[model samples]
Target: MGQQVLYETPQISIRYDDYAEWLHVEWIGDQDYESVVSGATKMLEYLEQQGCRKVLNDNTLVTSMWADAAEWGGKEWFPAMRAAGCEYFAWVYSSNVYSRLSTDLTIQYTAAGIVILTFDDINIARLWLQQM
Candidate 1:
């Protein structure tokens, strides 16, 4: 699907795919709690603006653990995103073991309001989001 860049930084890039009606968020490099929150907040804004229900959250380039933000992501951000109209989430895991652990931690605290699937491959994640 064709996409338009909604936001970008050294740490993250948020893109809107109008054709598929989803937000594609790529989180790059090491991330701390602050960077995760910042990137997620920016993504939320674009998701609301674009009226997208699905999110392809790619963490393939993330190199550090950010477990400190896991609870906040699952408890706070996910709910707010749901409230903002999100329904499906496809998360592409980081290859780094620590980053993968952090991603798993976030899922532990996530509620059942939305459909969420995690994948090791971005292509698989994209396909899942497209199907949703």
Candidate 2:
């Protein structure tokens, strides 16, 4: 649980962990798209500081609506993350629609490699990371 804060706001906390090449984000409630993108950027900076060339976005604690503004936030942040040298990305999500959309977007952008996993198992996600 070695967590380093990358950014913090009233609604979210973005952190990085050493044990895993991942950026763990916890969103509390509705937040503007700019805040989300800024938080994500801070996470990316932390990843760079940790020498992580890739990241696993563990969104298990995320409870915000992934519609409208959040969707726009993701679109803005994801491309910037790829350009910032994030070579691989993966998310462990509970929603089928979110997982499918995220995975599909990852493939479509052709930026970093991306994978989405259901909540039942994370071993596959870890395996995908190992191959990165």
Candidate 3:
């Protein structure tokens, strides 16, 4: 499936795949708590607008872990996204060990009933979500 850019920022780019009914989020550079929240919120908004239930979040390029944002993503964003029809989430693991630590923490709280998968390879992530 192909995608079109729905929103773009210096730190992140949000794209939508109509055929797959998924949102493709590419994170670039380091992000702080605010930017993390804002970018994710923007993606969720676009996901909802597209009436999609899946997301492919490529965080491989993120240089640092906004650890503080993990709690917010868990406590806030995950539920909202799930409510907005997000049933599947596929995350491309960060190469940085520290970033992986933060991602692990976030994974713990992505909420129950939602499918969450993490992959080292982007193509694997895409293929897994594409099955949905």
Candidate 4:
């Protein structure tokens, strides 16, 4: 199957790569907490619809910290995604230290069933997901 671009704006792009068996999201510029929740929910919906259990979330392009979004993802999104059949979340760690820190904080609150891994290289992330 061809890739489906679920949502795209200046700040983010969400898609499903069938061959990879994962949802892909590349964040661009700075993102606010509100947009992250909405966009991420849509991505998760597409992920479940496509029967993909993994996500290659590339935050390397992001330039700002989103602590609120991080908290929300941990408290709400991650669990919902897990219930929807997502098992592995491969995050492409942001080059920005603060963004990675925010993600770490989010991970601390994530449900234990969700397998979250951080990677600086997207290819490594993809390989990791492929094995999942």
Candidate 5:
């Protein structure tokens, strides 16, 4: 396996594994909407440069939300991802009812080929990505 780059910010940690064809992100600390959007945008740019087509976002650690900001961020990134050739986007999350519902709704409405998965197991995430 090739080395993965881990980008650490105050609100999140992003790991990109080239050999595994996955970009794994875990939100950390307090998540402000603007910060999340900025970080995600940077991560997407990096992934595009690295030719990543799939992503696994583990938001289990995300402790806060800026709903409006999150919605805007999603709007900005979803189309950018399609342009960058992203094929799959999955979420590995605990059973947080509101978060799960919100993420599900977003995925359901997105025109991009982003798939959101709520799973308790890491292996399940890997399997989903492999099948993509």
Candidate 6:
């Protein structure tokens, strides 16, 4: 499988896998609302440009709370992602309790039209995306 980096920052890295035809989004270090929104917006843009339907969202390295972005993620970003042709979203949770709570909050706010599954293991997330 070939992968290309679509976007990268200290806070996030987004890559596209040619063989799998999915986006691999890795969130790094701490997160603030601005950083989360910025990274998510970029990911959405790439999903539109690539016309990919699946995403593997990895947050295992995240260490801070970003609850502030939760509502926006569910209410705005996710809907935009869906419109951009996204079908499957596999989110790997961070070990941090706060980060996990934030992830749960975002999921709670999300609507039910798209497939969004959460996992504690990155490998499982990847496997799920592959199956999709």
Which 10-residue window in model 3 sums to the lowest lDDT?
105-114
- Which rank order by TM-score, best down to worst? 6, 1, 3, 4, 5, 2
> lDDT of candidate 1?
0.92
Root-mean-square deviation of each candidate, in angstroms? 0.9, 4.1, 1.1, 1.4, 2.3, 0.7
Global fold similarity of model 1 (TM-score): 0.97
TM-scores, in order shown? 0.97, 0.60, 0.94, 0.93, 0.81, 0.98
lDDT of each: 0.92, 0.57, 0.87, 0.86, 0.70, 0.94
Which one wins on lDDT? 6
lDDT of 3 by residue, 1-132 (tens): 578899998999999987787899999988789998899889889987999889999999988978888888887889888889889999998898777777888877667467888899999998899888
- In candidate 3, which residue pairs clash? none
Query: Clashing pairs in model 2?
Result: none
lDDT tens digits, residue span 1-132, model 1: 689999999999999887988999999999999999999999889889988899999999999999999999999999999999999999999999999999999989999498999999888888878887
Q: Which stretches of candidate 5 lie over 4 Å from their true place?
A: 94-98
| lDDT comparison, 2 vs 6, better candidate | 6
Per-candidate clashes come to 0, 0, 0, 0, 0, 0
Clashing pairs in 1: none
For candidate 5, write residues 48-106 as lDDT tens digits: 87788888887676554435454655666777887887778777753555555555555
Top-down lDDT ranking? 6, 1, 3, 4, 5, 2
* Predicted structure 3: lDDT: 0.87
Better-scoring candidate (lDDT), 3 or 5 = 3
Candidate 6: tens digits of C-alpha lDDT, residues 55-108: 999999999999999999999988888888999999999999999999999999
